[model samples]
Target: MQISDLPYTDPGVPDARSGPRFLWWLGRNQAGGQLKSLAWGLLHFGGVMALPYGVGFAVQAVVDRSGGRLAFAGLLLVLAGVCLAFGDTMLHRTAVTNWITAAARVQQLLARRTAHLGSALTRRVAAGEVVAVSTGDVEKIGWFVEAVSRFTAAAVTVAAVCVALLIHQPDLGLVVALGVPLVALGVLPLLPRATRLADVQREKAGKATELASDTVAGLRVLRGIGGEELFLDRYRRASQDVRHAAVRSARMWSAISALQVLLPGALLIVVVWHGLGLVRDGRIEVGELVTVYSAVMLLTYPLRHFEEIAMAYSFSRPSAKRAARVLSLERTTTGGPDAGPVADPAGGADDPRTPPSGDLFDPVTGLLAPEGRLTAVVCGDPDEAGRLAERLGGHAALDEGDVPGPSVRLGEAPLDALPLDAARAVVLVQDKDPVLLSGTLSELLDVPASGNVTVDDALTAAECGDVLDALAQASVDEDPMAAPITERGRSLSGGQRQRLALARSLVTDPEVLVLDEPTSAVDSHTEARIADGLRTVRKGRTTVVCTSSPLLLDRAERVVFVHEGEVAAVGVHRVLVRTDPRYRAVVTRETEEEQRRSGSTANSTDAASPNGSGPVIEIEETA
Candidate 1:
């Protein structure tokens, strides 16, 4: 499709078998645009090749002393000039259109693939590599796509020009014809080395970008732990490696550029020197000598396209390979012992479109939450809790090595077997890390929902009134929802961020909502209020909370104690705490920590404003 028709209804399934195959798929999809570009390129290069012929005819007309012929030749030159102007402008126009549309298509495909893979993408592919694909790699791929048409036209023009010379003057034509091929093909030997150097440069640059990204993301933590200098030193070393690799790649490309110029100049000299001898021997006229010299000189312009095409391929091959590699990551369909074989295309499914509604079951862990119940899972390790939470949402740790058991199913329908979007509509997962995107508070909370829970209801359920007060105190508008959240909600305290994220999640009100340590950042009183609010708001809907907090666990109808990665006890929270020693140890440790944190909070509150009405501004440091 053309650039104007962009944002395709479907970018279509990419043939990501290899780098070349992916590129070929892109070209095939944009065949119409490529053909149009080729036509314009032919028009432009044809006029250029005709210019020297027009000039030569004018010179011959002058020697014959024919006024009419001279005027006619001048008219031909004017026509060629007009053609050159129109054709050149349109060729460039079409080329850019091809480039933009191709890049847009690639971007769409990458975005779709990322969505399908979910958290698994960063696990399998480097974050910096994904960033590079979206930014630099897409541009390189588009450049190669746009260059193909122009390169074809230039190659054809060079061949046609040689054929014309061979017919007009065989003696000098033989040398010119053979020399043109030599000039174009001479750089072939240097290409393999150049491409290898470019690949090395790309790899080193990706590592440096990843390192810099990590350092920035954890800058606050590094400074707090007195480890900023350590990471900075590591990053500096990575940057130096990238710089060295870039220099090596640049040197190889520079050598290739030199060869292109050197070989073309040599060909020009040979054709000119030979043509001059033909004129001296009376084998050809003076005008014919000038014509031969002008043809060789003008041919250099199109000849440069050879080197450009080579360079474009060198950069884009790796880019296409990377894009293909990311696009090929399939969402694991086999979530349980009975999960059927599935397509390799990420998120693709041949299953029945209808999603079933019933109890949520994970066969691997033998955990079952009957439909319309709030179930609490007590896991000692936060890492294990996070993985369990993700699995409940159909995001198993397949990339990290399959942990045997867990294809979460809703009744008879397997969640992972469903299309990714369909699976998400069934279950929503919120991890301990609450990443609030930068935006107005209203916008941040605006997400796809079942509409069963309103914004006010969710905010109340999350016990975020203090968060609202914090926003209102900091805002010029005095409207808490209108207040802006800076990147990652860095403007808010840890507690405030957690509460706001809970509000956002509550707004969705999915069929099965899985929360991992949702209230860990908040104080005991707030956690108790949140636990009560959650039970009220989520009444008669399936919910799973992976937490050890007694406040939240006490609200649950049932608690499942998981030890050594398997179900250890299943009963009411109070009964398990009293009867199950292993379960009690995990719960007791968390209870002790919460009590200590509560004591610290009471001491801090005692020293606050005398009226106790003053807002307690808690940054992450204070929290």
Candidate 2:
């Protein structure tokens, strides 16, 4: 089956049984390949048993010296060698093929599940755990799956060899046959303990991986705040813990290995001792005794597989559990009756083409962002506004049981009811500091849209004309319009990065553009130009700017003041700033003194210096 056909339906809440079920489901999907691999394994291992029996016949013929049969015995020995050589080669080939196919299937299923989960995956599972599952867990699962057929074939071969020995010489055969199984089964009691140790080792490794990922992602901020050493120390501690867990797991595996070796050696010794006695008593022919010895020696090959199967299970079980946890995460489902196709506010749903509604409303916050208008949200705390923007964009889950205040309706249809692709098509949330991936300027602005907004137009709209001039003056080989932007635009100044991100967002020309503090980094001159340019460029499209910037606020048609996360006042920016204390407090930095005192003393001292340089600088004046 194609990767696209794999089921991504949420299996509901995961339990202990989920891991095994996931493996069983994978096996069922690839049953045809699995069966073929099994058949090949049996053919290969069956060949292994025949070689030893032929060797015994050759030895018996040599001992008898009867009627030129010695020549036939030599032929039997040569045939036995050929069968073994061919069987070993074919076994390796089939097993490797099975391993690769199983790994590919699991990888595809994971990719499909990840796409379905989207952002919800980060919320449910640590980023490190996801990485581990995709790479290491997939390998472990493939190892276990591929081992299954070989394990079965090995068991069968062992039984067949034992039966062959019993028919040739019952006295020695019984002891050899019985002892091999006892040696192989002896490892079973240690498996549970070994598995537990392995689980602990895996958990510790996952935690260390998480700590490292977090440290790397935040390394810049950590260094800026002089917390790099602190985080480094913590990571080192986590690494040490992982090492300890790994050592413990290794110790358990070592004990199991020792037992596997000891039991097999003892069984071999017993078979040899008993067979020699039977040879001396004249109760068994020399050729028959040779056959019994050959069968006993062949038993070791299958017995080794038993130990390997145990090892595979010990590693794979936890990996499967991790994969199942990721697969079980459920995406938020809008429970309302299907509202049918969404109508465009500008035209009818039956129309072939129309711009979808740009309205965004939050039931929890009672915030209404109307369609085809410029709106500004002024929040007392910038962090709160940023979080609210994520909720409004449907990137996060809202608290249940709260009144469904104002569903973000596209005409009569709720935004929540729309598919992710459809919703993204209508509303785009551009962060104050949106990430700019490494690419040429042209590539960065390459968004999904019909019209071509020249690089000059986007730059003008974001007031990035100066940034273009700077790049030109630098004499960079790349064109200003085609200049490469580094990852997160780190090469550019804060203002340049902010404008470039805004330019990129504008290039999309989304129906509803929700930007958080888009102009906070730019100078007043650039901010004013951006505000004015935005008004003209997005005149007919809906735009929501979450900023306390007076320059941006003046350009907005309506400004909503958010107090304690709820809308306290809504009107023209100047009107609310004049009448409302909450609006005045937010836009005018009324709490600057209180905020300074609460900040770190060292940073406060730097801010109060006569030179006007500080680690914790405030941009409240811009607002």
Candidate 3:
């Protein structure tokens, strides 16, 4: 099956049955292969039992003094050795296949779920948890799945050996068989405690992984603030906690292992002692006594597997439950009839397919970026604006009962109705500090869909011409377009990274490009060039710039001022600056004290100088 076809819809309120159901689903998906593996396991385990029987016969024959049959017993012993070797080889081969296939299935499921959830997945789950699930948890799940058939065969084989021994010497066989089970049962009470400890270890490990990821992602900023050592200290503490938990978990398993070895050894001793008595009393023939003793000894192999299977299960069960939890995350619903097959948009603009809706209306803030216009969203509180943006992009669900306005709609279509790919294609929401992936300048600018827009043209529009020149001046052999950017564009200045990200978004040429403070990082000259360039590039298409930048606002056809996350004012940038007190207080930030207010920064004078006729406004501070 294609990776895209994996089920991503949550099955709802997972219980004990969830893990088994998922495994059963996997089994059904690979029914033929699983059956073949199971058959091989059974054959191998059966062969394992046959060897001990053959050895017993050989021993009995030596004791019987049957001179002519002595060579026959020797030949049987040789054949038994061959069977044991063959059984071991086949068992390992089948088990490995089961492991690899099970891991592949889980990987496919995770990939599908990640795509289905998109950005929401990170918001809902820790980044490290996702990484751990894909890596460590997947392997543990495979271990349990592959262990299932071998465990079953081993159990059955052990039972059969016990029965055979009972037939040969009822009293001794019964004691050995009964005592082995009692010792195995002793582990059950400790199982819950062991699993709990294992869970704690896994949780701490996940947290440590998350801290490491966070530290790496923010390494540049941490260094800039001289806080690298602080974060490093915190990460070390987290790692130690994980180590402590791991040691605790290992102690439990060590105890379990001790029991596993001790119980089987004791059982062997009991069987040997009782069998010697029977032989001395002449209650059984030497050959029969040998057979009984061999059977009991053979049982040891399967008994060891029993312990191994138990331990494998205890470790894997928690991992499977974690994977199941990830799989259970519901795909965000867009509450409309599925968009049926449409002609590929790649065919041409005139193809029967209509461009998807691009309007974004938010009920909470009563904000609307009407179709086909340059709109500005001015939020006094940047955090509130961020929440609105998430909801607008359909990355989050709104509590409609608590809000009292129309939902965000793309054209006439609800944002959720459009498939994730189609929605993303139509409306690109650029963050205030959009991440620049590690790549060459050309590659960074070449986002998913640029249509006929060339990389050079996108860079010029975002006013990154100078940035490219700087890269070239550094005597770098790499083409500016080919230069390798560090993660999050740490290699470049903040303003340069912001512009590059803008150029990338501009290249995509989506129907509605929602940019959050696109020029917040750039200086006046570049900001002016970007404002003018955006207007020229986005002429007829709908573009929403969520910023308090007066230069960008001046270029916008409509400026919306948001106060306490509500549309407190809306008008031309010039008109709002002159008339609206809330708008004036936010945009002008005229006083020195106002600039120092929490979360507010000195507004840049870039736009006023460009047009040469507007009042000055301060820029917003970035997190």
Candidate 4:
């Protein structure tokens, strides 16, 4: 494909049968670019082989005192220089294009798989391994793909040059041809050991990356529990292992590099010594001797491609294997690689049996959220609440030891039976701690919307006026809406970040919005404003919020209290609080302490914690 057609609309189904096959699949898809690179490489190396012949002819002409022949040699040298300049430029251009396109294809595929699998992708693969495949592994895969065409051209050039030499001067040609092949193939036997060392280095490096990612993701919790030094020491040890492995791999490659130099230098010495003998005995002209010497030097250049291609393959093979493994993963509900939605005998105009939109029902918990209403789910176990939220979003069976739950259904159609994108479009599950990707405010808020909520409205609904003000303050030179956010929104307070994340979810305006502890970080005052705004904006839309906050539950149209992993009761928030002692205990574990600290008439918006959310929420969750 041309460069303009990038970010491919469809990267096509990958041939993920094996690593070698996956690599071959990539090559076949980009045949046009590969062919272009190979053609240019041949032209470039063909010119490189001509320079020696021109120099030798010029030398002969000079010794014979032939002005016409020397002029012809000069003309040939000029032609060779032109070819070298143009061919080399185009060769590199095509090679780089090939590399970039291959990487882009893999990135697109990974992104698609990531979106489809959701959190389940991480369940099957290590976070560090995924990170490596996307970053360094991607570059290595591209490196090998780009190296193949150049290696082919180099091989052709070597063969062509050897044949020409044999016809022109058999004496020096035989030794030159034999020595060059030996130099290129001699390192083949050392490759298996070097590759093994490199693989070890890669494994250790991946583990270290995974450790760093985990530490960063939970740094707050680690600090709270005073486990920072414990994790830090573990990371240090992992990093040290990576360093040791890298050194071992580097040493082997260094030996290979040394051999590359030594073998070529030794071959050059033998050629020079033989040429000198031929010249002294008057068997060949001085000009022929010069031609032989320079040709031997030129052959050294193309021979290096053999070593480079080998090293490229060695690194890239593992990367391709890892990529293939990730791509091969399917959601258990997805059945297998070729599975699709099961067709219903009672069909409608639509192809799949998936319903357009309706109530979300979880049979395992007997929780039913009616269409065009807001429902609040209260469970004493925060972990259980999180898992139920995951199931509602069509991601099932993530945690172990939990009873197998029935598939959540939208109308009569099971959510798991629907396509991932279709399900995501209908149900938006915002976890308690949602991630805020680094971008401008506008970019962050630019999500698929139902045209029902504007950015201003969403921010207002989520009580994010202070969030906008903070962003504006940070980016004084730019528009407030265009202000840039730091990675994970770490620059903002936890409460402020939570409010912004709430605004983002509101912007999506999906058919079924599932929010887990959407306002746990916000103060009681802001939380009340958010509850009011959320109710007003989502007046007729189905919204499921998994939270124990009284303000939010008080605002919900209906409250479904789950007890012992089953729906124990369903009614208004006040009714549940008054009638259900279990639900009251779950929602009001620290209400007396919080009220005493903040005073009853102050709207429950405690001023003790600057970030809106205080230690009370955490204490209740743990209790």
Ranking by lDDT: 4, 1, 2, 3
Q: After superposition, how far is residue 475 of candidate 4 from its true place, in Å?
A: 8.1
Question: What are the lDDT figures for the candidates, one per model?
Answer: 0.83, 0.73, 0.72, 0.84
* Residue lDDT tens for model 4, 442-512: 89999888778999999999888888887888886847788999899877778888888888899988888
TM-scores, all candidates, are 0.83, 0.79, 0.83, 0.73
**Model 1 pairs whose backbones collide:** 335-407, 364-405
Candidate 4's C-alpha runs over 4 A off are 1-11, 58-71, 111-131, 211-240, 272-289, 329-355, 362-388, 395-407, 416-421, 438-485, 507-509, 517-541, 545-623
lDDT of 3 by residue, 1-623 (tens): 22243332432222323666665565565555556556666666666667666666766677776766777767766766676677678778777777777777787778877777655567567789899989998888778777877777777777777787677668777886797687667677777888899889988898899999899877877998999999999999999999999999899988987887777778778877887888899887767666666666666677777767777777777777777767777544545445343323354567656655556677667677777888898888887776666667754532212332344676566665556676677677776657777766666766687575667778889998888887766537846766677777877888888888888888888878888788988898789889999988888788888888888888888887777666766678887775555576667666656535632233434333333223433333224
Give per-model CA RMSD. Answer: 10.0, 7.8, 7.1, 9.1
For candidate 3, what is the lDDT? 0.72
Runs with alpha carbons beyond 4 Å of true place in candidate 2: 1-17, 66-77, 113-120, 166-169, 335-337, 342-355, 377-391, 394-408, 431-435, 463-476, 485-498, 516-536, 545-556, 559-623
- Top lDDT hit: 4
Clash totals for all candidate models: 2, 0, 5, 1
Q: Of the candidates numbered 3 and 4, which has the greater TM-score value?
A: 3
